[model samples]
Target: MLNRSGNTKYQIKDAQQVYRQLSVSYEKIDSTSKKLVAFADKCPNIDENDISSKARYATLCRNIRMYAVQVLQNFSLSTRRVPTEDEIKQARDAKQRSDNELMEKVILSIPGINGKTLELSEELKPFIQQYYQVLQYMQQAKLAGRDDEVKLLESNLEELAQAMRVAHQN
Candidate 1:
């Protein structure tokens, strides 16, 4: 059997590996979320009945949910103990700020798409707001060590994912 120090070292290495994987996953999800939002902005006037438009919209919604889930999972893994209320609030604020900056960048990146971008942003506002709200709740639950609440929130997210998938079914 390994000595206590050797065992601890192995555990630390395993955790570092998991952290790296989670970081990579978060980056991919963030990139996909930004691309989807950009696509929405560029195609604001897309015909709802068009198969491609429906597929793209569904994909965007799915990506948002996927990003939220990954973020919650990452938080759950990274935190060693329950966080204070202040910490939770700080995390929530930071995430919102980051999201707003991303939105601004996405909007500014495509010139002459203002009207379309506005329309798309307006149409998606409810969904986007609700998704983020759920994500915030998930973060709180995870930080509080409420596994049951986390599972419930995950179920809600999965339902949102299913709705998006069904909306684009051919």
Candidate 2:
């Protein structure tokens, strides 16, 4: 009887640990998803003729969205509680709405800059600012055990660095 009780206690502790991990993962996924959506929304506007630049911007947004979806799926599967189809659809719809609203706000704020050509330094300014912001957020995400966010920020930093290098080269 004593051995059985001991086994029961151990099982309970293990279950608690699993629950805790799931909770933490869910919270991280939620927070990082919001950040990804916001970043996508705030992407800088580029000239209409700059097809390559627009492609790069679109790729970045796509990558961010993919990351968010991947994180959500991975966490849900790991917790052994896959979300329903309706839940997944709802999350995607919410993301779409948020992206639309944010993009509208960004477009309205930068009305005159659409077709204008910016100097190298003017163009690099936003990347530099974003680099610093990502660095700060990366630190906080690390402390919070938000590995998905950290990975995303690290990738953003790498892209910013490459962009700056190219800008300097030209």
Candidate 3:
């Protein structure tokens, strides 16, 4: 490759080496694609009325609990010191997405799930948003070294966690 100043810039010194690497990558991708398709095909379709299908729903609710309190557990500034803004943003997005996704998945996929559970999932969307906002506020308080505010928010988080359990159980 030539530079703008008419200087030689050795972009790819061994063209054959690049070709070999690409061929290896292509083979791996093809193998992985076939495996993924085979795995998906082997999984049985979930019917909401089927008792066996409740297993996945149980797993999903377990994940919801994990996501609900994920930030509070990770953002313990006292344990690990300050998290980067990027870390906070990613955590925040996950927390927000977690709540919203509960309703979406329940509504779209599990029609035979209890009607009350579906409605509760829908309501939990905004509740999940508020849960993380308090988390953000708690993060700010921790940074400010205002233990008072942080403690209060910790209690609030506990309450939110309880509500989350209630919602998921519904």
Q: Identify the leading candidate in terms of lDDT.
A: 2
Better of 1 and 2 by TM-score: 2
In model 1, the runs with Cα more than 4 Å from the true position are: 1-121, 165-170
Per-residue lDDT tens digits for candidate 1, residues 54-139, read 67776776678677767867776875654556776899999988887655544333333342334334444444455556667999
165 Cα displacement, candidate 2 (Å)? 88
- TM-scores for all candidates: the values are 0.29, 0.31, 0.31
RMSD of each predicted structure: 30.5, 32.2, 27.8
| Residue 87 in candidate 2, Cα distance off native in Å | 27
Q: Taking the tens digit of each residue's C-alpha lDDT, what string does model 2 give over 15-96?
A: 6677778788777777776676666545566777777886777678668777877877776777664455677689999997
Clashing residue pair totals per candidate (backbone < 3 A):
0, 0, 0
Model 2 alpha-carbon miss at residue 159, Å: 77
Q: Which sequence of candidate numbers ranks them by lDDT, best first?
A: 2, 1, 3
Error of 3 at 132 (Å): 0.5
